[model samples]
Structure formats: structure tokens, C-alpha cells
Target chain A: MAATTEFELVSPGRLLLSEPVEMVVVPGTDGDFGALPQHAPMLSTVRPGVINIYKGGRVARRLFVAGGFAEVTQERCTVLADEAIDLAEITPAEVQQRLQAADDQVKEARNPEEKAAADRARGLAQALAEAASAAAHAHA
Target chain B: MASLKDLRARISSVKSTRKITSAMKMVAASRLRRAQEAAEAARPYAQRMERMLSNLAASVAGQAGAPPLLAGTGADKVHLLVVMTANRGLCGGFNSSIVRAARHRVLELRAQGKTVKLLCVGRKGRDVLKREFADDIIGTFEEQGSKGITYTEADRVAQDILRRFEAGEFDTCTLVYNRFRSAISQIVTLQQVVPFLPSPAGNDNQGAHGGHEAEAHALYEYEPSEEAILADLLPKCVGIQVYRGLLENYASEQGARMTAMDNATRNAGEMIKKLTLTYNRTRQAQITKELIEIISGAEAL
Candidate 1:
């Protein structure tokens, strides 16, 4: 049996990634987890974070998923992102602005629901910012 | 018989018209190709979203406390028509088809003792409908020259719709647009957005992946409770659905226009050929008669 599994990441604008990857780590609603081939079927709401794609006994690539859902079959994983960016295309500075905007919305949010959504946006933005900064100095 | 100058003018005019239609056809064809690709790419995301929504919505079908969007307003006294069309025109009957469908439906609703309101999302639709249904139009929105319509724009439209719903402005809502069927054929579509209809029963009990649809069904305990979940999800659903509908309509318009222009161009070419043939025959006859007159005059002298 082959040790690797296939994963596809897509959005309305573009299909970001599709290939055989060793492992795919995603941020599940309950918590973050890593997935491999032949995994049990699962569906989860994914927040913004770096999706670490492991291949060839090493971490091969990283993707920043803004907000989306993940569907896992027995042998493949599909991530439908509302918005996603290649890690290389993103910058810490860009996400910092997003974080600031989200924070401002938090202050202006009138009700609890609005505030909660705004809060989620802020958390996701901050997470993206942190990931961008950490990976900024890591050449390739 | 028509004068020689008249025929010459007619020929030139037809030629110019042919050129314009031909150019338009080329432009439409290029735009249509792009729109078609985009629409094709969007299919997967749309289907997946619907599948997820259906799964989630099915779970709460018989259960109480479903959101208003899924649960519906529980009445049909008032109706809102969300008319979607192109912001621009010159695509022959593309814009008119949607407006025509909306007009027919609105008239039917009025006759049935129902209240109908118009909420036009595109400039072309508003321009057409306002001539007669001026009072019925509540709001008009057009995002011309934008890179493309955004979810944020969709959200804004949904927010407005939701506000009206809260005030009980509409009990049943319908969306009017054109469905992209093919390059040659585009079908005008009218979809009911509210008053959730229970899907056909007994089609699939098996999950998408599993052998049994029943096994694939997901069970979730709502975080804040089903009522709250519905309240939140329903509004978002409205936005997403509208956003999708807008994109679909946009693509459809371009396709329809492209096809229509192509036909026009071919028709113009055929007409120009016919006109040129007539012009040539008339010129030959005039020349022949003049030569006979000159020969007879010389013989008499």
C-alpha cells in the first residue's frame, strides 16, 4: 500500500494545491490536527492558519487558509477555502493591517453576535500575522 | 424605380451596419469565453456549498427552532423579487428576458391578491422595470467597473433584505435571473429563495462517500442552540446564495449576448451580399440602355 495520500485545496478564484502529500495539518473547529491517508471521514470548519503539507519525510509546503471547510474521505482530503493565499505571496505587513481592521470592528461592534464574529476575525488575522512573521526569515 | 443615388446610399449604409455588427460579435465571443470558464470553475464550489447546506438543513427539517431563512417566515402574504441582470446592455434580448419574466410574475402575483415589491440589483433591470413599476421598485444597486462583485457586496444586499424581513416586508422572496445553459441557449430562471421547501424525500439515504446516504448524514449539537444557529446561518446563507446567483447571471448575460451578436453579424453579411447584387444588376441595365440610345441616334444621323 502507498504511504502517501492526495490532497486538493481550492477556492472560487483558483485551485491552489493538488498533489500527493505525506500529511496535511488543519485547524479543526474543536482543535488543530494532522491528517494522513486512509483516515476516517471527517468534516470541520477551518479557521485562518498555515496548513502544513508534509511530503517526502519533510514539511514540503505551507498555505494560509483564511476561512473554509474541510472534507475528508478515506483516502483524500478536500479543502474549500472562502479565501486562501500562498504563503510566499503573503506578507506580515498585509495581515497586520487586516488584524488592525478586525480590532477596530471589535470596538465598533454593537451586539454580542457581531462582536463574536469580529472577535473571530481578529483571532484569525492575528494567527495569520504571527505565521507570516515566523516564516518571513525562514528562507524557502 | 428607385433613383441611382438612392441605391448607392442604401448600399453604403448596409455595409457600415454590417461592419458594426461584425465587430460586436467578435467582442462578445471573446468575453463569453472568459465568462464561460469562470462559470465552469465556480460550479464545484457552488455544488459543494449546496451539499453542505442541504445536509445541515436536512437535519433540522422536522426539528423545531430552525432559523427563519430555513424555517421561512411561515407566511406568503408579501413577496420580494430580487431581479438580477447585467449592468449594461446591447446584448439584444438578454436583459429583456429577465425583466419580462419578472413582469409576468409580478402581474400574476398582483392578480392573486398578493403584495409584490421589486428590489433590483442590476442597473439594466432597474431601468427597464422602472418605466411601469416605478412605485414597486424599492431599491436599486449597480456596481459598475468593479473588478467583480464581492461577497461583501452580497452581504450588503443581504443585510438590506434581512432588515426588511425583520420588519415583515416580505414573506416570500423570489430571485429572477438567467441560468447559463449553453452558448446557444440561455434559459430565464425564477427561483424561490424563501419559504424553504422540503427537498424530495427518498432520493438519497446514503452519504456522499459511504454506501448509505443515511450513514453520511451529520448530526451536530448546535453551539448556542438551534434557534441562534439558524438566526446566524440563515442571514449568511442569504448573502452567499445571492452572491452566487449574481455571478451566474453575469456570466449568462455575456454568453447570451455573444451568441446573439454572432447571429446578427452573419445576418448582416447575408443582407449586404443581397444589396450589392441588386446594386450591380441595376448599374448594368442602366449602362446597356444608354449604349442602345447612343447607337440609334448615330444611325439616324
Candidate 2:
């Protein structure tokens, strides 16, 4: 049997997930990185994307995180996400709504800071929409 | 000396007040439970964030180019007090205690020849402080956690503070709020968020076991370099600190409200008891007077 590492997904609201997993893939700001047992300790920022959790050599669950930080140790990987949601629970309509709102925000932003924030939101919303569609295709 | 009808009215009024207070107590009890759970659930994230940041801060400490958030602006001329209190007034002494502590800090800082700027998080704090320190108050936030304390709200406040810091607004920032001890007791706590100060307990333990932990930390590899991570994490640390303060203050508010309402309910019960007793006594006296008058009238006939 392969070694399992403890994975914890924490949001500010609560601890979303805490369990032993065979592997986990995090979408870091630099790139996607996978953490397995005995991985070297590393800290990186997480971008808004899907985090794939593996169990028994198969992707067991997928979660969407807005953005935050990830700290990887040899035995455990803790992800402090600003927001996290189970991809399975997201509806297409919700994604569309978010995209629309983000688009409107981008158009209505009056200052540089507001524009930057709105751009980030739009990027996140776009990513979420794509992820939702991809998940839909995978399920189909 | 009161009429029987007046005593009856007073007794009923007290009874209704008791009912309202008891209801408020129950509501606060339930809300307190939820707030306590939320605070508990957020502990792990905040703790881990602190641990990681402290590790990074330890590595980056004393560096010439350290982030200003960690190393501070190298001057204590200006201070910002982020006073967190409840918006509502039902809580007994919760808001007042926090405001009092903040006011004391403001006075102390001013006495030391430091400029003090106030950033109030809740309306109650702003309302109280505005009377005396109206000119010093820079910003006021209200109803940020009306539904429940959220990270986004804290992040907004943190971003505002960061912007102010970037503009050279304040040298030091302190967060003042109530630390929930129990449903009956909450202690007013003042925590320095800017120029990040590690908790004294963590500092002492780290000093005692510095050697091995330092070795362990040295093994961890940084992705985009230590400085970048520290810069990113420092602002987050501020946000998390504010988030924690808000959460703790919220739980304390609920706990305080629960206790206050419990006391109010008890006081109302006592008043109702007294009023009911007076009502009974007055009715009995009125009946006795009527009986004596009827008996005397019969004797005259």
C-alpha cells in the first residue's frame, strides 16, 4: 500500500476537510503542484482553481478554492483558502451569475484599486465557470 | 398608598418585562453557542497562519529590507487604535469595557507624545469615542458582522489599514476587543496587530526550544523566496488578526448579552414578585376596609 499524507483544507469560516489522502494536487500561483507522503516542506500561494484530492489511485474529490496559501510539510499539507466549495455542489446557473456580476464590476470600477480587484474577481469567476463546465463534461 | 388597579397594572407590566427579558436571554444563549462554535472552528486556521508567519518572520527578522509590516516603520510617532465593539446596546458593559480600554490607550499614547488615530469597527465604539475624540477618529465601520463575522469584512478593514500604512498614516496599529473567557466574564484585550508582535507565551517557548525548531524551519524550502511570502503573509496576518478580534468580540458580545439578559430577566422576576405582593396586599386591604364599612353600616341600621 502507498503512503498517505494528511490533508487539511481550511477556510476562514471553518475547517472544510481534514483527512489522510494518498495524494493531493494544488493549483499554486506559480503552477499546479502535487503533494504526496514524504514530500519536502514547501510553502506557496494558491491561485483560484480546482484542488484534486486522490485516493486509491483515483481522484476522489475536487474542490474549488478562490485563493489563499498552502503549506506543505512531510506529513501534512494545510491549505488556508479564502473560500472553498465542493465542485460537485456548484450549479451552472451560479457560475453564470458570478461571471455576470464580475463582468459588471469590471465595467463599473472607478479607481485603479477597484479595477484591479474587479479584474481579479473576473478572473476567478471565469476560472470557476470553466471548471464547472469541465466538471460537467467529466460527469457526463 | 397605590390603588389596587394601579398595583395590578404594575404587576402585569413587570410580568411582561420579565417575559421579554427571558426571551432575549434564550436568544442570546443560542447565538452565543453559534458564535463560540464559529470562534472555535476558526482557531486552527488562525493558529496555523500564525505559526507559519512567525516562522517566516523569524527567518526574515533584522534584515535590512524586511517588510514594513513585520519590522514596522521605525518610528512610534503615530498610532492607530482599531477599537472593536458591539453595535447594539443590550450587552452589559461589553461595549463600554472595550471602549474604556481603547480610551485609556488613546490617552496613554497621547500622554507619551504619540499621535493617536482611531479606527472604530463597531458603531457603539464610534458613538462613544466620537463625543471626546471626534477629530481623532479616522474611520468608522458598522454592521460588518451583523449576520456573522466574515473574513471578507475583516479583509476589507485590513486593506484599508494597509492603504493607510502605505500612505504613511500610522506607525503602530493596535486592536482592542473583548476576549471571551466565559458566558459571564469577558476581558478587554489590546493586541498590537501592526509591527507584528509574537505572543509572549509563544516567544518564551520558542526561546527555550529555539535550536531544534530553527533547524526544522531551515529545512523548509520557499517557492518565490522568503521575502515574497512574508510580504504576502503579513497583510494576511493583519486580516486574520482582525478577523479573530471580530470573532472573539462577537462571541463575547453574545455571551455578555446572554448574561446581561439573564440578569435582566432575574431582576424583572424580582420586580414582578414585589409588585404582585404589593398588589395582593393592596387588594386584601381594600377588601378588609369594605367589610369593616359594611359591618359598621349594618350596626347603624
Error of 2 at A54 (Å): 2.1
Residues A89-138, model 2: lDDT tens digits: 98999999999999999999999989999999999999899888888888
What DockQ class does candidate 1 belong to? acceptable
TM-score of each: 0.81, 0.91
The pairs that clash in candidate 2 are none
Tell me the spans in candidate 1 whose CA falls farther than 4 Å from its real position.
Answer: A1-8, A14-23, A28-30, A33-44, A54-60, A70-78, A89-127, A137-140, B146-152, B195-216, B220-232
What TM-score, to 2 decimals, does candidate 1 have? 0.81
Clashing pairs in 1: B205-B213, B205-B214, B206-B212, B206-B213, B207-B212, B207-B213
TM-score of chain A of 2: 0.94
Question: Across residues B235-301, which tens digit of lDDT does each residue of candidate 2 receive?
Answer: 9889988888888889999999999999999998888888878888888888999999999999999
Instruction: Compare the candidates by TM-score and give the number of the best one.
Output: 2
